[model samples]
Target: MEFRLLGQFELRDGDRGHHLGGPMQRTLLAHLLLAGQAVRTTDDLTRRLWGTADSSTSTLQVHVLRLRRLLKATGCSATIETSPGGYRVNLGDDTADVTEFHRHIASARNTDDEVRELHALDAALDLWRGTPLTGVTADWPRFPEVRALTEARDEARTRRAELRMTLGRSPDLQDLRDLIAEHPEREHTRHLLMWALHRAGRRKEALATYEDAYRYSVGQLGLEPCRQLRELQHLVLSGG
Candidate 1:
């Protein structure tokens, strides 16, 4: 049996391909995938899926039973194993899109070449088409998947900034400005934009970009730009 969570959550058991749907099912599967070879307790699963609503352990067992049957019917070898307190999904290849993304990112981290790292980071970012769990909001708000996706996106932004600096397109301020406009809370992108503007001999415009970014960050995220951004802004203003 082959399980895939890269684009869509899918299970291929022999000749049959099963598309897993429903918010609860997706949440259950995602929770299992994020556990990383550990068995989750029933209480934890219930809390994650149903929040504070009073639910029985039997309810979780029923859901697991259904999921196990569904996988079996699909001819996949995936088994939902029952432990003393919880359950686990054991399948081969372990091909999850989220996992693949992290693997690529970790591979990019040790490389010295910014161009190649940027290419790999972009590919990892491309795996995310939307929110981590589309149509599934009940349980995802507190899940690790959300945090993982958020960090991956931020890492991609930082890598892009580094790549742009390495390419030395000082006049590439336009797109960097656009990126900041789209993600004003991303101070790193704004920092890179400021540098690009300064290098292009548009010192005043660069300063303005910093001002705009500062205001946007304070207003939108209720936070200030990072120290690096502040330092860059000061250097630009002082003609350093």
Candidate 2:
């Protein structure tokens, strides 16, 4: 069984996919999955689900029951185990996309072989179907786990672009431009975009990109550009 939480929440048994249920139910499962093997107390879950810990324990139990039933219906061997403190979903050897993504990223980071690392990075990035936790709401994005996952995704993307440039492959300029436009605060992406422009012999545009980022950082963020970005600006200016 494969649990896909990278985009939409889904459970796949063989070739067919099973729905995890409606938004609230999906939200419950998402929280449990994000918790991994750790027990999430009823109080913690209730607060996450309902914005307060005052929600009835029975309400949480109902959702867990439905999730267990859905797992059984899908023929997934995974189980939702109840402990003294709270509930946890045991995935056993089953795979979750987010977990797999991190594993691949770790392998990529650990490997000395650039070719192997690039392959790992490619596999890591391919797991994303869309935004992590696409449909399910219940304040999912507000969770610390989700925020960390989002940051990891952004780092993976930036690393891939940097690796491609290092390997003498020009990254898609339009894509870099769009990424900068989408995430203006992402200094890493901005730095890469500037580097890509410089590598493409568009030196003036590279300098302009850095200037724009510098202004955005200082004017909006009330901070100066990082040292690496400033050095890149100097390199462009000195015709390096």
Candidate 3:
């Protein structure tokens, strides 16, 4: 079985997909899956879900029971095991997308081979469907886990683009442009966009990106870009 938490909480046992359940149930499952074998104490979970509300233990149990029944019905190998004070999710022979994503990223980080690392990054990034925990409320005090996942995704994307440039691969200019447009303050992606434009023999456009970035930084944030960007602009100006 494969449990995907990068987007909606979904379980796939072979070709069949299981809904898991509604918002609260999905949130419960997400917490358990992220906790892995580590026991999330009953108090901790109740605090997260109910926040000092009265009569939460039985309610929490009902959610867990429903999750277990759904897992059983779907033939998923994962089980929600009861610990002394709380529960733990044991994946058995199953896997979670978040785990796989992190594993691939770690593999990429550990390898010296650029080509191999790039492929690993690709695998890692492909696991994301969209904004994580989609349709799940950010209201569980806005899960830090979800925020970390998004940050990981952005870092992976940036690293992959940098790797492509290093390997002399054909730069995806449009992607770089899109990234910069989304993050005008990202000097690194601006650098990347300029480099790609220069390599494509559009030195004029590359220099223009630097000028635009300069104006944006100074006008909005009262700060200039880092030294690398300025140096790259000089290099472009000199036709180097």
lDDT (C-alpha, whole model) for all candidates = 0.71, 0.86, 0.83
Give per-residue CA lDDT, model 2, range 1-64, as digits (tens). Answer: 8999898778887788887787888888888888877899999999999989999999899989
Q: In angstroms, what RMSD does candidate 3 have relative to the true structure?
A: 2.2
Candidate 1 global Cα RMSD: 4.6
Q: Which stretches of candidate 3 lie over 4 Å from their true place?
A: 52-55
Model with the higher lDDT, candidate 2 or 3? 2
What does candidate 3's lDDT look like per residue over 28-93, in tens digits?
888887776689999878877776645469999999998888878878788999999899999999
Candidate whose lDDT is highest: 2
lDDT of 3 at 214: 94
lDDT, residue 215, candidate 2: 93
Clashing pairs in 3: none
lDDT of 1 at 189: 81
